[model samples]
Target: MTMTVVPAPAETGHSVAPPGRNRRVRQHWGATPYLFLLPALTLLGVFFVWPAVTAVQLAFYDYRVVSPAEFVGLGNFSHMLGDDRFYTALTNSGLFLIGMLPILVVIPLLLAVLVNLPLRGIKVFRLVYYLPVVTSMVAVAIAWNYVYHQRGILNWLLNTLGLLDQPVQYLLDPGWALPALVLVESWKSLGYYMMIYLAGLQSVPRELYEAAAVDGAGPWRRLSSITVPMLRPYIAVVMVLAALDSMQVFTSVFVMTQGGPQDGTLTLGYYIYDAAFRHFNMGYASAMGLVLWAILVVFSLVSYRLTRGKAAAR
Candidate 1:
């Protein structure tokens, strides 16, 4: 006997995941980012946000270690208005802003351009440049003491080059101390800024530089046109960071100068530390901190304005 034949049902092009699995996947996508961000958010709140709030509260109160906190009602700020040391610290911070701006922003970009060249041993040059970035500031400061000594390498070099009539006590001279600190700060951080600019440089298309060269454009022209325009975002970022760090300079000052040599290198940051810990003036220190925060905001705004341009961004 002949058996009846039947055709199987046609298969659909797509497989339908189970409803439970689909729901689970959607839930995972929604929750995963928040889960990843939870730790960082917690840390930020604990460290930065909480401290900021506490500082604001302390700014309005006279909180000393010896007694209970008393409400001051801006007395600390009014006192800050008359503090001579405060003005001196402000002036020193401004000088740092000026001295480090070019050294940190412009010079690093130029150096990055040089090191970005396709040449032998370029990686070695990058490493050498970046070594100082990883070096501890305390160690660097200690080493620089010898460098600034009367019979030190720096003095010898200056004398040999006829730049100095004699070995001037760099960190000891009131007129020279601030500038010397500026130099040290710049040298310590130059490598880090260079790496930033170098990263930006490498991200730029090789074809642009080659095309510019083919059209008889010089290195300077190509850099001014292609490199600058493309690296606008990086420039803005670097400028803000440089301004913030320069204004908040403390470690080098604390380690090397202790804001001494007639308080020539007394930056606002060091002064804040001094007021808070050394003199037990928490309210005053908090007030000064708020002022410094305002200054940082202003500086960041100015830096962004200076570097404002349409960037061929990453």
Candidate 2:
């Protein structure tokens, strides 16, 4: 007997999805993240983007808060070339960068290595080191003011050690003002850089140290060969950060010296503030700000290239 054969349903060129599948996919994959990000994006635009654009526009226009903005094109920037104080501020900023680099970049690594040792109550030491980083800068500056005072503990210790003939006014002396501020800034931020190095150290393999030790490598040799090379990226990051901090040093200068003692501590940041607020030369200040920003950008680019090239060579 011949069985009656039924043809199965033919497949279509386009397949139909389930009724709610597309809706579910769309709901799960889209819009939610953007919706959650809306607040942050709005805040950033309002606070950062808007202010940056205003600053750039104001760089070309003379605005003294009381007077109408007068467009002068590159006049503000041109004026900077003839301004002696601008050059002085630039020079001081460079000094800060030079002084802070070793303090933040090199010394912090050693500090991190010291704190990273598996010793009892080491966390307490780490916490103490990081305390200044978390403390308010204003408070730190006030505390440092006492430390730098003519009759303060620092001077007393120096006198006791016969390092000085008499107490010196650190903040009031032109020769010492910038260096004093640099030390304060460096000390306050040392903990931060230390934490960064500590984090980098955590990822390094203990086996490398073991192997190096097995090969008769001493601590300094291992540090120079393994730790330094491994921490290159961290060093690059710290360098860029420290450079930026040094270049834009304002609060310490303002609080401690007020750019006094013959303007020895007049950093670019403080100069911008002085021009804008004290002298009411907002346009010139904005121009200087732009120049400072350009300098920082250049420094970052150079640092990145050097670090990346070294990394690639290795």
lDDT of each: 0.91, 0.92
lDDT of 2 by residue, 1-314 (tens): 89977654444455677879999989887988998999999999999999999999999998898999999999998899999999999999999999999999999999999999999999999999999999988889999999999999999999999999999999999999899999999999999999999999999999999999999999999999999989988888899899989999998888899998899998999999999999998888899999999999988897889778877876
**Candidate 1 backbone clash number:** 0
TM-score leader: 2
Candidate 2 overall lDDT versus native: 0.92
| TM-score for each candidate, following the candidate numbering | 0.85, 0.90
lDDT by residue for model 1 (1-314), tens: 99976544435355677899999999989999999999999999999999999999999999887988999898999999999999999999999999998899998999899899889999999899899999999999999989999999998999899998988898999998999999999998999999899999878999998999999999899989999988888888888898888999999999889998999999999999999999998988999999999998997787666666434234
Please report the TM-score between candidate 2 and the true structure: 0.90
Candidate 1's TM-score:
0.85
- Candidate 2 stretches with Cα past 4 Å from truth are 1-29, 306-314
Specify the highest-lDDT model's number: 2
